[model samples]
Target: MESRDYMNLSTDKAFPKLLNPGESLLMSLKVIKFNKRNKAQERTIALTSTSLLNLKGKKLQRRMDITSLGGITRSKHGDEFVLHSPSEYDYRFGSPLKDQAIQTLCQAFKNLTGRTLYVWESNEISLKDLTTTKSDKKKGLNKMPAPETAINFRGEVPNFNEESKDSRGKRSRTIFAATENPSAALLDDFTILKVLGRGSFGKVMLVRRKDNGQLYAMKSLRKDALLESDQVEHTKTEKLILQHINHPFLVKLEYAFATSTKIYFVMEFMKGGELFYHLREAKRFPEDRARFYAAQVGLGLGHLHEQNIVYRDLKPENVLMDEFGNVYLSDFGMAKMLGENGSTQTFVGTPEYVAPEIISCAGHNITADWWSFGVLIYEMIVGIPPFYDQNVNLMYELIQRGKLKFPVKSPVSDNAKDIITKLLDRDPTRRLGAQGFNEIKNHPFFAPIDWVALEAKRLPTPFTPRITDPLQAENFDREFTDEAPTDSVIPENKLNMILQNQEQFQAFH
Candidate 1:
């Protein structure tokens, strides 16, 4: 049966009442609504002077007050628009007559609230514009505040002071006032050199600071995509964790700042690139070499667990190496802070490395990272994960089965196999590192590792990359390095539209 049929039957049984009296409809149109899961459903949107109603036939599905409307934005290349609501999740709708629907709604909103609705081309909307009122102006909201000359890390504000200085040691500063272009003001200090990586929502580039000529990796993410996907809170959490934690085996965040359209994270550049790249070239590593990398990663995870932060994502791709082949855990996007003995129900992690508890939705804690660590160690010695399968569902079933097997002719020691079995236990309570990281550190497989010397980085590295120059991209994938490394220019009008939404990223710094 069609999905619309299900909607009709559901609405008929729940809501039989029609529109309220004196609330006449002004415009009714068939539209597609994108729900929280991003699935599209057919519904009728009726716009009135007092409210906007979502309906199926004569049954009401949802009603939004017109007076409470915040803002409206139209997509650049489609008949789609997002209705911004400060008090609830933003509503996304698409219609064949999108222009007419938006025009009629905006007219009604302005007539009722005495505020003009500015339709932005992009999906960005300003909450400041939505929540501000004439009464707020009476409270002196129009005054200009003092410029910030010194660096303040309390709120994670950007280091604008660094950008304000020149080669001559002279300093000039701007207040980042409402009329100024914030993106150009902040990003102009760095010269983009190459594209380091790309993902669905953003890209990472190798950039150089103009003042000291130091190299760094700058990650840029789109604000609209983050909001549409409901990842705003996750992004904020990742920034906070990165800002507070400082360990030798963990990647360090040097700076974080946001523009009207994007957020940027400046991090120390790792010359040797991701461990995954080198692992693929070498196929697999010897037991001793694998132990070296695993020990460092264990220490990194242990440090995070000590701070009550769970590193939910752990895999070869996130393990980065320096020129001397020292590993550092990167990408804390999935990490979260929990209260004492707390567990989270969010289903996240790479499919192959996901823990059994996460798959069953049983709630997970720091022990989940131990499961992924086991998978990483097994893959490092065997050239692939223990339960790896091309079919994701079957692979998950294998993981839940909690079976551990070694190749018949493999050279892996008994100590290695024993540790893997304990860490891969189906019961999180019985996992090797469930009690504390010291259990894993004391395992016989890592007996050769001098824990004290390793943690201090005093021991010599087992391997080193053939790096001839600091600026060379030989260690990184050629596909990313060959691409043009230019930050796209935002139109002046679009920039203004994004500036209005700066309140959403005030803590990005």
Candidate 2:
């Protein structure tokens, strides 16, 4: 039997005791009860851990009751609110709801022999019998504040079959806030097939337009996530860039929609997956193969810079290609629009691919993207990043010093190394800027590259898929491997929720 199968059959009940020294399980706590006026009755109180588990999938909320309460209350008289509860009394909590029955009794004793209350014991075991204290409770006033969540409705409102329009009705001009874009609606002709990716913000899906049966990629981000990350401006900036810019090498935005819960972007789907996964699988590409991809990316970056937009994140994962071998730059989630002088201050980028200036939290321009391009080209020729370390701190220090080394045994040409050296120059001013790509294109490194022909998607790809089936498990490689297999925790429910929610999201507009 497989290891996973064995695990499924095992019922040792020892998993909960597997914590190592100094390791502890942390669970986010939410209030299960509220006091009068719908406020948190008490800031801190002890409750059984099992009680929290009962509220597993429920959102935290408050309720109010006008009845009497024994706990000390905080009112306008804050100075005299503090008081000690009765020393020899038993406190209790009662609930009238069927599923919400709660009873917590606390008996305060002044000392060992101060007082005693007689009560007959029932033969049944109590919760206190099962509770075990490994150590004394840590002395501290623990404060837990509930997180604010912005709702992104996941269902659509029902529509009526009857048309409400009259034959001679007058139409009035309606303007949406800021831009005159239309509200979001479901494209009845398209079907969402599978989830492409998911993150804290939202998710991406593989969709097929029923009109032409053409596959397209759709990315959806919840407005709450944007608001929480304080990246609302960043998302808006990407929308603006997508609106004003038009380039073949860049991922084209087909359409966009905004709902109360999320914003969706429909774009051309790249079936070839991430460039990173391809490079990892092939080990390393030949110099010509590397140059072909690099040149296409550089051209795209150059076009973006010309339009005054900076692609802050330029790692291989953000670069994509279609099944036909046409490459395009994607992931504008971290992109930024340049100021009047074409400048930006935000420090953002993937660590291995980030420019040194960005690491130091200093300002940089389109030149930063070129530097990252240099690192990418180097990585393409070699299987590993130029400066990688097991320790991330050491890696950051090495990057700050701008140190990149190449193996002598590697068959990469000298011209490729020269371009890398120029691009990796620590000084941003002399760091082979946007025009450096032109210099590289004319170099002997790309002697066989017919730039004009390649841009038109006519050039043949050096590496063709030995396996033609798109859904083949082996064809997915590192990119889709995790999603290809299903055992436990396969994210099937999340995907279903997203699909069902998409319908609701379409109507939420």
Q: Best candidate, lDDT-wise?
A: 1
- What is the TM-score of candidate 2? 0.59
- Runs of candidate 1 with Cα error greater than 4 angstroms are 1-185, 489-501
How far residue 204's Cα lies from its native spot in candidate 1, in Å, is 1.4
For each of the candidates, give the backbone clash count.
1, 4
Error of 2 at 204 (Å): 1.4
Model 1 agreement with the true structure over 175-263: per-residue lDDT tens digits: 00001112232687799998887653477888999988999888887775555444667788888888889999999888777777888
Candidate 1 lowest-lDDT run of ten: 171-180
Top of the candidates by TM-score: 1
Local distance difference test, per candidate?
0.71, 0.52
TM-score of each: 0.65, 0.59
Q: Which residue pairs come into collision in candidate 1?
A: 256-509
Tens-digit per-residue lDDT, 1-509, candidate 2: 01111111123344233333532222221121222221212121122222111122232222111011122211111111111122211121111110111211111111112222111111211111111121111332211111121011121211213222221111111100000133233545467766665544565676777767877777777654444334556666677677667777898877777644567777877777667667767778888788888878877888887777788788776788777666789868677778887666665666567788875657888888878888889888986667664333344557877457887888677888888888888778888874645765676666778889877778887765444655432333334345633212313323543454344343224
